[model samples]
Target chain A: MAAIKGFGAYLPEQVLDNAALAAEFGVEPAWILQACGIETRRVAAPEETVVDMAEKAARACLERIGMEAGALGGIIVGTGTPHRQFPGVSASLQQRLGVVGIPAFDIHLASVGGFFALATAVELCERYGPILVVGAERMSQVMAREPRVKESAILFGDGAGACVVAPGEGPVTVLDIKMQSDGTFVDDLSMEFGSTLNMNGRTVILQANRKLRQSLTELLERNKLAATDVNLWLFHQANVNLLKQVGQALGIPEDRVFLNLPRYGNTSAASLFIAATEAQAEGRMNPGHAVMAAFGAGMGWGSALLRVQ
Target chain B: MDIRAAVRKAIQDMAQAPLPADDSASLFTGGVIDSFGLMDLMTNLEEILGVKVPDSELMPSRFETVDKIVAYFQARK
Candidate 1:
C-alpha cells in the first residue's frame, strides 16, 4: 500500500480578480462572480515555465518530508497545459531537481490528471521507494490568446500542486481509485494543441454532475462505505455550483465538502491536490475517510477513497 | 407549499437574494440566475416539485422567467 507522505503547492504571485476581467470583457463584475463562483485567479509570470512551477512544488513536498531529490524513486507529472508538445515536464523536472537516472513521465488526463498521477504513484510505490507526483498547469496562456471565451478565460488560472507518495503507514492511505472516460462527450470540453479552448458549458455541467455522481457512488459501494463515512469530499474545482449539485445529489452535506476554487479558480489537474493540501493544513481533514472526485476534458472523470490517519 | 411559492423559494435559495416582485421578470436575461445558478434552480425544483425534469426539457426558453417555470409545472399537473 501507499500513503501520502507530504504535500505542497505553488500559486503564482499575480492575482486576477473578477473586476479586472469584467472590465476587460465589458461585463459587470457580479456577472463573472455569479456565473463561475470565482472571485480571483492566479496568473503565472511570463518567466514561469510549467517545469519551473512543478520543480518548486516538488521541492516543497520533498522539504516537508526532509527528503532530498535523490530519495525519489520516480517522478510523474499530470498536466494538459505543457510548455511544449515534445519532452514532457517530467524529464525537465527530473533534471532540474538533480535526480538523474530515475524513470519519469507525464499523464494527460485534463483536470482529473492529478488523481491519475496519484493512482499511478500508488502502484509504483509497491516496488519502488518514494514517488513524486506533480500536477502543474499554465492555463492562463491559453486564456490570454482567447479572451473572447470570457467565461472560460475567467475560470482558468495557472498553478501547480505536488505530493510525495511512499509505501508505508501514514496519515493518508490510498484505499482505492477508479477512472473512466466517455469519448462521445469529447466536444463538450476540449483544446487542441496551439488552439483556443472550446467548451459547451451547460452540457459539460450536466454531464459532469452525472458522471461524477456515478463514479463516486460506485467507488463507495465497491469499498463497502457510505457517503457519511467520508469526513471530507474533495472534488475538482471546476465550478462551485457544479460541486454543490453533485454533493447534494449524493446526499453529502455542504459542510463535508472542501473547496478552494474562489482563490485559485480552475487550475485543471492541480485543483484536487491544491484543495487537499489546504484542507489538511486548515485542520478540516480529520483522521478518517476522504473522497476525492474530479472530471474534465476528454469527458473524463475519476474518484478515489483515502483513509486519513 | 404552493407551486409558485416553491419555485420562488428555490430561486431565492439558489441566488441568495430576494425574489423579484414581478413574476414575469426574466430570470436568465435579467441576471437573476446564471448558468450555474440555473442548474441549482433545476435541482431544487426537482426536489421541491417532486418531479424530474427530463434532459430534453432543460431548455432556456422554458426557464426564462418565474411565470414560465410555474406555468410549465402547472401544465404537467
Candidate 2:
C-alpha cells in the first residue's frame, strides 16, 4: 500500500540503567535484571514535551529523505503522553514543523499506536501524497517510581520515532497488515488523563504472548509466507524474553528478531519506529521481508508486513 | 492428585523459589509468580485439573491464591 521513505528517532541523553534503578527500588541489580535483560533506558528531560520530541524526530526523518515539512501531506502522531488532551501532539508538531492546511491528528493506542498509524498511513499515502507518522512518549514524566506502580515503571523509558510513508517507493514496500484489540482486559493496564501507569503485569504478558503471535501468524499466512520467510523481526522493544517467546512460537529464529529493550526500555508507542529506524541505520535489515508488531494499552496489537526490494 | 496439590506443584515448579507456608497467601504480592510463571501455571491447570478457565476469568487475581484457583475450577464443575 505504501513504502517507508525514511525513518528517524530521538532518545534522551539521560540514562536510567540497572544500577540507578537498583538504588531507587532498593533491590540489587540482579533482581531487576531477572525481569528483563534491559541494561539502560532513556529518560526525557523534565522540560521536554511529547510534541518537542516529535518535532525533532520528524525533522530527522524528513532530513533523512531530503524532504521538507511543507512537502508532507499530513501528520499522524501515536502517543499516550500528549502535552494536553485538546490539540494533542500531532497538531502541535505540525505547527512546530511550520506546516499548515493538512490533516494532523493523534491516536492513543499505547504501544500499538505507531503501528496503527503506520498501517493507516500505508493506505492514506495513496490518497494524500506522503504522510509523516510519529510515535512519541514521555513515559518517565507520567509514571512515578513508587513501589506500588513499580512493576511497569521500571519497564518504560522515553523517546520519539518517526517515519515517512510515501505513496509508492522502492526498496521497501508495505505489503499487508493485521490489527486486533480485546477490551476485556482494559482494566488490566491503564493511565488516566491525570493518573500514572497502572497494570497487572501477568495479564499484559499473557495477552501479549497470545496476541502478538496470532497477529503475526495471520499476516504471514495471508501473504502465503511463514515465519522463516521474514528476514527481520521488529517488535515493540518491550521485553527481550517475551519477544523471544513470540519469535520462537512463530518459528522465527532469535537472530532474526531485533530487540532494543535493553538500551531504550519500552517507549510505548515510540518503540516500534525507534527499532525500525535503528535497524535501517544499522543496515541490519536485509533485502527481503520484515514483519513488525506491537502490543500495548487498549489491549491493542497489530502486525505490519513489509517487503524490501 | 487433588486440584490444590496439582496447582501447588505446578506453581512450585514454575516459581523456582520457596513459596509461603500458608497456601492461601497472595502469590503476586509475595513476588512468587510473575507473568510467565502464571501462564505456565494456567496451562498446567488446564492439563492437571481438566478445567479450562474461561478467558474472561483469567484475571491474575483469580489465581493469586491456590484456594481461589480451586474455587474457580469448582465453580465450573
Candidate number with greatest DockQ: 2
| CAPRI-style docking class of model 2 based on DockQ | acceptable
Model 1, docking class: incorrect
TM-score of chain A of each: 0.97, 0.97
**Tens-digit lDDT track for model 2 on A126-146?**
888899999999888888634
* Residues A152-181, model 1: lDDT tens digits: 888988899999999977778888887777
Best by lDDT: 1
* lDDT (10s digit) by residue, model 1, range B2-73: 899888888887774556889998776666876667777877788778888775466566787899999988
Give the TM-score (vs. native) of candidate 2. Answer: 0.89
Task: Tell me how far candidate 1 lies from the true structure as C-alpha RMSD in angstroms.
Answer: 4.7
Kindly report which residue stretches of model 2 are placed more than 4 angstroms away from their true locations once superposed: A145-149, B1-33, B41-54, B65-77
Pick out the ten consecutive residues of candidate 2 chain B with the lowest summed lDDT: B52-61
Clashing pairs in 2: none
